[model samples]
Structures are given as structure tokens and as C-alpha cells.
Target: MAPASLLDLVAALPPSDGWGPSVATETTLDGVPYAPYSKADKLGRMADWTEGKDRERGGRQQYGNRNYRDQQVYGANQQNNPFGIIAAEEEATFSVVDNTRTTTRGRGFGRGGGTVFRGRGQRGAQNQRGGARGTFQRVGAGRGGQQQGYDNRGGRGGRGGRRFGYRDDKPQRNRDASIQVRPDWALLEEIEFTRLTKLSLDTPDGEDIDSYGFLYYYDRSYDKQPGAKTSEKRLNVLERAAYNVTTSSDPIIQDLADKDEGTIFATDTILSMLMCSPRSVYSWDLVLTKQGDRIFIDRREGSSLDMVTVNENAADAPLETSEGNKDTINSPSGLMMEATHINHLFPIQVVQESESAKRDMPNEHPFYNPAEETDPAASKAYRYRRFDLSLADSEEALHLIVRTELDAVVKNTISGEDQFLTIKALNEFDNKAQGSGGALDWRTKLASQRGAVVATEMKNNSFKLARWTTQAILAKADMMKLGFVSRVNPRSPNDHTILGVLGYKPREFAAQMNLNLANGWGIVRTIVDMVLKMDDGKFVLIKDPNKNMLRLYSVPNDTFEDEGSVMEKVEEDGDDE
Candidate 1:
């Protein structure tokens, strides 16, 4: 007979729901029924039977039986029964079983429903205790007689206790912390100017005068430090003669007071002055002292100080010596008059026009028209005759410095350069406690004390403005030069011109540009202005509102040339065919 193929044998097997016997079968030899002595003996006989069946069925039977045995053993162990325990371990090795007697129903009985112990080549129905029920009761004992039971207490020899609320420990402080400071000097300057306006009044007579004019000097000092306090004080002296001549009860004066109740000039306009300089010092001398504590009061000197005349004899002498001996010298007429007067004044004023005349002219008036004109001859004569005292050399000039400093601090604070305290310091003379000057200095001293605090504020404002400006530039970069153009449909003459110049149909442009109502109007205005320019400039902008896709348009001229190339040749050939 030929051996069966694996496929044929598989085909011969019963269906999943059928209970067919295996291909290989077992029968007792000599017509005697075979029996197993112990539980181990039964398992050994089962393994042998499986091996023999596999040999006859071409290994199929053995594989199936082995799988079935594995599943049965696993299921029995899960039940935690004594038979399951024996099948798991000792049954696979030695044919061991337990045969013992116990009292049951008030009678001594030998093991009945237990395992049968079988020797080699022996067969019997001898019953014995099976698996763990056998007489071997020391199975789970350890070296120290420790027993494996439910209530067993021992050291941590098994699984460790579950970990509870454990976490990593770390420090909480940062070593590299620092603060940033940015100064917004420009904004500060604007704020300072605005504050000055609020503190003064406009005159009905068209004098654009403010309390600041009455101030001949202002001085302030600031200290630059972290977290410092800011302090400011101003000293302003009125032109005494002007104040005395003007009536205190005048309507203009009363009106000004009412308008600017708390300002520097609210109480007395004659002596009122708003400190507007950003820095502390204003100097009379530009060369000797770059920065000083004084600003000179009174009118500015012009070109009259540029030249000096002396007798030929005294020309060679020093200025001081020449002036001293001029009174004793004889003149051309035999009269001892001074040879010359030294022009000690500085030329501070270039041209002086009446303030009222400047006010009358429109800001955009043409250059050809006269805003104001002076007689050249008369102007030259006045320049030659005008004389001024040497304020730079006077002791009173130094007092202007303190007043200037106070005004500058106030001005800087109002403008937004809160950080002025970080870069400025009090004047040296302010240290001395002397009269009203000392009091003024004391007021300004607070600025230096609070410099650091103001500086921090300024720095923050600067950063904010910078960020805002950057965003604005980026947002406007592409359309900025396009001027005021809109994406609206042609409802007006301006709309038609804009659409014609852009070379896009109104609906198409509107959809592609994604322009809002306001933005559409702006775009239209921009294009109109660009068209008005004489340049043959082209406007190219992105058409894809979602992305940066570009569309370009050129200004139309009467003389524009158009030419065709390879695509035209293709069209011509197609037409002929």
C-alpha cells in the first residue's frame, strides 16, 4: 500500500462539527483491556499512543494529539485542582501517585477515586490519591520550613511592594535671569511738546506766545540707575520790565489764566515758562563750555559783533591794553576819545522778521510770492549799529543753567523718554544750598534719584513702538507704493480708471485680491495717484490673496508695439490645413 499524502489525510478528516475518530486507533494486545497504574502511567501511555499514531498517519496524528494534550493540561492547571498539579510537573517525569486511607461517613476507607500506581509492564485497577492529593505533603516547603499558603508571612522575597507617590527632586531657582531696557526717546519728545501746549494759551491778538517765552533759563538733571526715582523742578524769571508795564487785570491775562489753570504760567504769564529741552544744560558759550548750567536771558546779537575797528596805532596792541589806553590817547581831531570798542557780543540771530507777518502767509504759499520782505539797506545799517552786552561773561548767565535743567527733565518725561534718568545727572552747582536757586536744584534732584525707574519704562515703550512699526511695514510693503486703489466694481469714474489701469476685470480682481470695503477704496485711490505720475512705471502686485502669486500691469502709452513668435506659426499652419 502507498503512504498517504498530508493533503489526502487532511481531506479524510471529519468536518469541524463532526465527531470522527482519529485515523490511527489503538487496541489491546491478546484481546486484553489495557489499564494504567498511576496518573503518570496514564500520561506516559497517552504519549506513547500519540507517537505510534503519528508514525502510522505520517505525523499528522502525533501533531494533533500533542496539541490537544497541551490545551487539556493548560485548562486543568487553570482549575487549580490536585489532578491539574500532577499533570503539570511530576506526571511528565515519574509515575508517582498517592494511595492513602481516610475516615469518611464514620468508616475507614482506602483511596478509591485516586490515582492507580502502575509498575513497568504491569496493569491494574488499583486506585490511589492523584496529583497533590498523594501522600507527598512537603511539596511547597522551603529550607526554613516556610509553607506556601494564603496567610503566609515572610520577607520581601516575591514581588516588591507597589511604588507610592515617588517623584524626582530638582531645584527651583534660575541663575541666568536678566531684565531688558529699551528707550523711546522720540515718543518722549512728542509727549513733552504736547504737555507744553496744554500749559499755555493762544493770544487773541495772534501772538503764538506761550509761557515758555517768558522763561529765559531752565535747568534739570537726571540720574541713570536701575529703579531710581524721577524728580523735576523749574526756575523761571519774567522780564521784570515787561511784567510791570502790562496790567494784571487785563482780559487776555485773565483768559489765559482760566484756560491754563495749573500750568507754569497759570498764575503769572510774565514769569511762566515750560521746560521743553530734553537734556539738563543750555550753554551761552559753545566753545569753552559744551554743556553748562546757564542760558543767557535777553535779545540775541547778530552780525554787528563780527567786526571791530581800532586806530592803526592801537591795532597792534592787545584787546585789554588797547581799551585801557584809548581814553588817554588823542584822536584825529586832537580829542582823546576811545580808539575802538571791542564787540564782545555773540551773533546768535541770523534774521528777524515780525512774528505777525509770518503768521499771515499760508503754509503752502508759492516761493515766488513774498512772505515778508525788509529793505536791504535798512537791514544792513541796523546790523552795523545794533549793540549787545556780553552775557556769556556775566555772572547772571550761569543762573540760566539751573532753570534749563529743570525744564529739560519735565520735557523728557512728558515726551516718553522715561529713561532720561538713566543717562543724566544733577548739575554740580546744585549741590550747594543757596537761596531760591537751591530750592530749584532740590526739585530737580528727584529726577536723578528716580532715573532707573524712568529708564525701564522708556525702554519698554521703545520696544513696543519698534514691534508695531515693523508689523505695519510688513503689512503694507507690497501695496504701499500702489497708492489709493480699490477693488470695487465701476460705480464711479474713479472706479473705471482704476480697473482699466490694473488690466483686471472688476469681479476677477475683487475675488483674487480678497479686498475689504475699506481696503478696496484705498487700493483704488493708490492706483489713481500712480497713474497721474509722469513716469512710465508699472505696478505689480500679488493676485493670490491666499499666497504670494503676482500680477503685473504697465502704464499704457499711445506707442506700444506687439509681436508674435512660434505660437503664431502653429496657428497659421492649423488654419491652412
Candidate 2:
């Protein structure tokens, strides 16, 4: 074999199968078909940097960079090559460790784990991260690397790392309901605020069916510049024969119901609460009774529904002691009682109860009686109005009868005629308290920065203001007087002083607060339709304490009866006092 010549060895190789691949009997190698190649074809650059720029300049191909195209030999196999060199097994086991010192800007445990740089203004915000322009995040540890708690590399590879939801650093709120939900009650429907806000209905201005009671002239002195020393008046407790008769119990409403005047009946207070339910943060409930086709909105005796809530819609609403509210006076229930007392006392004090100056309504006081009542009647007039809530597409008419109220009357300066007024009071608790909701010092700011003070109140007590406006609009009052009343002592709620009064057109105030009356009417109609579909039984519409939702429950008729009419008992006790 060693003596054989080089030509003999080459000739012994069984005649070369041509220069390249064999041309006969084979079109493919294994399963891959052989591709035609030309000898003149030139291999592109190994590291082409100019191809991308050239293509970008519109001089070459459009789809991708030509420089990065495949450059490997078509049929080359390095393992089987005759000139391939094999390294020692010991040398193959040797590894190179990167010991170079690299400084990581920032390290976080989330998807965007690298250093988070922010502008000067965003430095103090803990949750405000920069955009994902140059963020480098590592999601998990590399193979043989120690596992880390967080990695920035796990980001989805986009400018500004992606975040799923909003970052809310505030503590979660868990509030209690005004009325306890009985286990026996059945939940019928749960509606979200997002859906309720989308509803819209346009109803008439309403027709005055009947008017009762009388109204005294509103004292113009209280309307002086708010927070003025001269305008400050002590809030007087008025023992007036005030009545909050529910729809089914009210004789006027029952008569109207018997006559089929409306399919729904509610007082202005109850109706406003239902209309403004979506804006509420605190829990509240109203009882509804469906008898045949008619539904009545009622409030239980001593119900929280009759009370006004303070800072009910604030971001940091007043919490109960159990919910971590340290200040007892600023607690929701405490604030409600204080607000109710102020509202009750502020209205009567602002009116001049002179028989000579008083204006009489079409009918006498509906619930007040001189023979049966010991206390004098309050200067309030009840107007039973009917609004047509029937949809244009509906076959049947849907009417709502609301029993509205008027507190006082004012002489129109221009027309020299009497204008009806709806009186409400906004009280200030401790502004420095946790749940103050960034309220300004009403005593110091009400006169000079009245708009700022009112704006703060609107933000904090959106639900309360909206309800008052709704009531005023429902009553068709020419003016809605919001009296600023402050406690005589910030620590004590027993006595209060009226700072001043501001008058606003109901519609104008509604616009300022973004209160949509049509939307409110629509919500009412929707709830009414829902209740009408159910059996003729007592139902309750309750606002969820923590979430923006409302739940309708079918309850037994005797649910609240065990309470034994505490409102009347309390009123009787007050009368005795």
C-alpha cells in the first residue's frame, strides 16, 4: 500500500463523482432537496454593516438587512472534514468566568427591575416609574446563576415597561352598611355604577298636583357676606311639627295612588338619594314596597336615610372607629348626626316666622294639626308633583309622583314677587382631621376665597351637594340657599353658628357639579322597572359601602318592624324635652 503511486491511489477512488455533488439518481440528501447553485454566485460580506444603511437609503432591498443574510456553506460538515482539528477533552472542560466589574444603576424586584430614573418633580413619588425607553429588567436568574427575587429582563421588550393596572398606594377601605343585611333576604339584582351612569332619561319639569303647608319669608340678613362677623348668628333649635311621611303612608300619596296618578311615589329626600346613589361612598338603603303595579319608596323609622352625610364622597371619607378613624366626632355616624342637627336647626333660624309676612299654600299643613300637635308647625310647604318618565319607545306611560318641599320664600328683587327657597346647611368639622378631605378653614376663607371653600366642599361632599340640588330642583324652588354653619366649638357639635348663606340657581349649581338630572331620572326609571318586574313584596335598594355598586334585595315585609318605630319615639322624647 505504501509503494502505490499517487495517480494509482487517486484512480482507485472509483472515478470521482464529478467535481461537486453527484448528478444522477439523487435530487435530495436525506429529506432535504438539493438546491441549484451557480459557481459565479458571490458570498455576501461576513459582517455587513453598510447593508442596513444602504437599504434604509432606498438603494437596495426593502424587507430586511441584506448584510445579515445566511453566509454558511450549503453542504459543509465540520465534524467530518478531513482537516478538522480536535482539542483535548481537558481543554474543552476549561471555562472563562467574566470577572469584569459592572455597575447596575438600579435594582428592583419587578418586571422593570433596573434602575428607575425620574425627573426632578417625580423624585418624591414612590410609585411613579420612568418610561420604558432604556429600561433593562431581568426576570429570572441565568443558568448556574443564583435566583433573584425580581428581574427587569422579564419585561415584554417595549419602550417603557408594561404595567397591568393603576398603582394605588392608599389603604383599602372596608365600611359597614347603614342597615345590616339579614341572611333571609334574597339578592335580586346587582348593578355596577359604570352601567348606571350610562343610563339617560328625559322627563318633564313635573306638574304640581297639590300643595300643602305654609312658608315663611327667608331672612335676608342671613344671606349677607358669608363668614362676616356681622352675619354670624347662633343656630337656634326649632321645635317645629315636621313630618317625613313615606309614600305609602302619606294620605296624599295614597289618594294619588288610588287614583292611579303615578306608578311610583317617593318623597324628595328618598328620590334624591336613589337618583344620586352612584355618587355615594357611604352605605345607605331605602325600602320599596310594590303593591300591584305601584311602587313606593319608604324610609324606616330612625333610618339613616333621613340623615345627611358629610364628606361622604371624599377620597378619604370619614371612617368608623372600627375602620381606623381615630376621631370620634369626625366618624361617619357622628358627622351624620351633627350634619342632620345643623340642617334641621339652620333652616328654621334663617326664616322669619311672622304670620303677617308668611305666604300660605293652596292647602293647610298636611301632617300638622293644631288640636293634636303641641308644637308649632315648621315653615315648610309640601308640593306633590308628577313627572312623566315614560320612554318614547314604550307602549305604556310611566309616571313618578314626588312629594317635594319648600322651606322659605324670598321676594324677587326684580319682580317684587315671592320666590320659593330650599334651605340646606354645610357644616365644617375639624379641617386638620384625617378625613377633612383637604377642606379650607371655612371661617377664614369663606368670605375671601368662598369659591375655593365651596369647591373643596363639592369635592369632598359631592353626594350631599348633589342630593340637595336634586331636592331643590324637584321642588321647583327659585333659589337654593346653602348656609355655611360652623360649630361654636370645633370639639363640640351641640351648638353651631351660621357663618353666612349663598344662593344659587339649582340648575346652575348642578352644572357646576356635573350633576346630570337626565341621568338621575334614568337611574330611577331603571330601578323602578326592575322592582316592578318582581313580586308584590317589600324590597330594599342598598348602596354598597366599599364598591361603586348597588344591590337590590327582596326582604320580608316585617324586616324593620322589630325596631318598633324609633324615629317617632325619639321625636316624642324630643317634644317632651
Candidate 3:
């Protein structure tokens, strides 16, 4: 049978009122028996998608949905007719297959799915990479990165895997776990500090000590005296941290404050816990003095400080030389010691109350817990700590130190140098207070009044940051020594080599350590605080290894027996019903 043309079918079929042209899907035009739909003009016509049609091509029942002006309705192809007309005559058809299969990925339907015929777009051709290539490109390959592997190893040779050109099936390198995340040092070998030597401290044979090379000097009196011990207080494991800013104190600070002569100071000795040998240590007496918003920190030795004492009367003063750097705290010798301005380092506003840790049971609560508001998201965990330079401020600030200020603390010549004048000044400044510029000395003026408490806190963090920065560096080195830095074929220690994996050089670490000498206290604070938290990890159970005492310990998940700490902790509840 032959297919009947739409014109022949229209003439032969009986008229149906109201509805438009109706043609039979399968009807014999002659003895050959052919279908009229094969050649029907209606193949290119449109129908509403919302209208449902019966499987036999009959219309579905729709109530009050007809448009008298235009017969548009819904869903003519609901009964599985893939080739149903879908758009008005004005709309072009869309082809799923484009002529260039590798290029344009034609989509949707031909009409308002609206693609041009022959699988083309109204605009232009696609790029060689299979995305639109002109003024109005709908898709572009640039949206996605190149379809090539990223070789981070900086090697010219192809890597392994079918994806990589090489046959080896392993990654170039495996990152060692963040072993610093644990107090792995204590668990391994005994970590020790290089004890400081006096003015006789040696510099490498060829290398001269930076005028500000770490003045590593030991003090028998200070070492024999542990200054002040961190008060034995109940510390909540995750709720509170035993940081120097809060718990630790240097003897210098304690002595100054204990005078009760309105003398206040801050120091960074807290870090000695991790750095000094056997956990007993103190630093080269660095003291912070804050006057109003202005802050100045200088290292003053024991003897010089001993000369300045609280006088009951002006006449009772032992050393009363008037007017000069010596007469004032600014002695040429004193100036030769480190001195520079410090800035506020801690951002106290970050403490969110709800996120603050709490104990299920507390033996003794802290005397001061400053209350603060919390957001819904912040209450979940200790997520507020971000130790990046993102928050650091740049000013007199974070910038380079002044050259004159440098001359003061750096002493253009060191003790061993051939300069006789330099050695004389250093010796004279060592054991005695030169003089007082009477009441007019800047030191006397600055120390006369109490300063904002923040000054004290910032001063405290300097030690905290210094202590931890050094510790973090050592932890990396220790991790390398313990075979964590490199992997080997044989699981033996001899097969591996200790390799440093830190992103920074030792010099950079040293620079950061000295950053507290001038500015960058807050930045150093944030970074060191973050590293210390990581070094200690989330568990408590901290200890002074040399003393063999525990401050806090983590509650083991596998056991009910609680850890015994040196300090009192929240005991487990005792209701055995």
C-alpha cells in the first residue's frame, strides 16, 4: 500500500466540527494499504505539551481548559509518541545531534528547545575544543580547566597511570600525617633546649652573630629559681587552654608586679615549657612597659634592674645621678639592649561564649570567665581560630624597625669584637644602673602610671608565640628524625632519611621569632597559638617531662579508668545505682 498525502486524506475524510484537520494514523489509500500520517503535513505542526492524548490518537477529557481564540492545550505526546509536533511554525527545531559530532552538543527539542535545523545555532560555529566560539557563545571549554593532568612535581617526565603518560602507578609523593598534631615529641625522645652561654657564647667560625643574634645567655639565679609556678587550678580539657598569657609568668614580670608600686610588666617566658631542657627554663629578661597606648619592651639584666628600688623618700634613693640615658632607663648601655614599641596583639572579641568549652562536671570553676554572645554556627566547635596573615595589620607597626632603635639594642659591636669602647660600655651597663634622669626620665614617666590591661596581655603572648614557633620548628625536625617525613620500601628505620618538610626556612622562623622585638605580636600570637593548639592537640594530659608531672590528659575513648593528672580535675560522678 502507498502512503496517502495530507491533501488526499483531507478530501476523503468526513468533516469533524470545531476541531482542526483530523487525519487517520493508519488508513489504506488503495489496495496497497498505506498510512496517511507518513506524508501528513501535520508532522511539522505544533501541539500543547499539557494535553494528554489516548494511545489510539484520540483526545483526552479536559474541563474548561479550552482557549476559544487559539486552540493551544497541553501534552500531545504523553502516550509515548516521540515525534509529536512541539512548536509553532515560527519557532525553529532543535537537533540533539549536530553535524560536527565532536563540536556542538545540540540539546533539548527542535522548537522552543529552539535549535536551528541541520543541528546548527543562529549565532556561529563552535570552537575546535567543542564549545561555542564567537561573540555569543553559549558554552565554552575555558569554563572548565584543561583536560590535562596537573603535574605539581615540576618534573618534565610523564607520571604513572594511563591518565599520566608514564607507567608507574604511584603518586609522586605522599604527605606525612600532621604528626605535630600530637605531642609526638614527648612520646619519642627527650626534647632538649640548647642552654644559653654568657657573653662568651660562640658564633659559627666564619659567620658573625647578627648584632641581634638570639642572645642565648644563661642565668644561674633565674634557672635555680623557676620564677613563679603556674597556679594549680582545675582546667577544663577542651574548654580552656593552659597558655602563658593566662597561666604562665616570668620572674621579671612577677617581681615587678609584686613590688605593688604600680609596676606592671609582661614577658614571653611561657614558651620555655616546650623549648628549655628538662622543662625548667626562663628567657633573657625581656620586659614590656605600656604607657597609655604606647608600648615599649626592653631586655634589662638582673644587676641593672636591682639598682632601681622603690624609695620611701627622694633623699633615700641609692643612685641619684641626674639627667642622661643612664640617669634615665635610656642609658647608652641600656639602649644597646633590645628596645622597641609593641602593639596590641590579641583580638579579645573573637571569644564566643557558646563555643567556649565546658566540663560535664567541674571540681573548681575559674574565678574569671568573661561572658560573651555566640552565634548559632559558632557553638558547634573551636572553629573560630584561623592562624593566617589574613587578619594581621601593617603599620609602624608590622613594618621594618627604625635604624636608630636598632643601634640602641644591637650595640654596633659585640663583646668579642676588637672595639674597646664597645666592651667597656657593655661591661659598665651589665652590673649597675647608670643613673636616673631624675623625675624627667622617659622610663620614669612611662612607669609612673598604670597602663591598659591589654598591654600586659600582648606582652605575655610574645613569649607564647616565640615559645611555640620554636617548638613547632623542632616538632617538624623531630618528626623527620623519627622517619615520619619519608617513606621507604623496607619498613626499617635505617632505610629512611630525616628530611625537613616545613614550607619555611630556618631564617624565616628566626625572623618571625624576632618579630615580637618590634611589632607583629598579634600575628605571631595567632600563628603560634594555632601551632601550640595543634602541638598539644585536642586532648589534655599536658606535662612538664623533666618534672614527670601531668597538667591535663585526654579521656581515652576505650577505657573507663580516668587519667591521673598532677592537678585536680573534674572527677567522674559517683552515683553507682
Lowest-sum lDDT 10-residue window in model 3: 419-428
Of the candidates shown, which would achieve the greatest lDDT relative to the real structure? 2
For candidate 3, the per-residue lDDT at 524 reads 27
Per-residue CA lDDT of candidate 2, range 95-186, in tens?
Answer: 54545554333334444333433221111122333343322233332333322222232222223544323343556877777788889999
Q: Rate the local accuracy (lDDT) of all candidates.
A: 0.21, 0.80, 0.24
Candidate 3 stretches greater than 4 Å from native: 1-77, 80-253, 259-497, 500-577
Instruction: Report the candidate with higher lDDT, 2 versus 3.
Output: 2
TM-score of each: 0.12, 0.71, 0.20
Estimate candidate 3's alpha-carbon lDDT, on a 0 to 1 scale.
0.24
| Model 3 Cα lDDT, one tens digit per residue, 1-83 | 99987767767867667676666556554564332333212232255432232211232232222231133223332444444
- Model 3 / residue 432 / CA error / Å: 59
Candidate 2 C-alpha error for residue 136, in Å: 23
In the predicted model 2, the residue pairs found to clash are: 106-115, 113-152, 132-160, 137-152, 137-153, 138-151, 138-152, 138-153, 139-154
Model 2 residue runs over 4 Å out of place are 1-169, 562-577
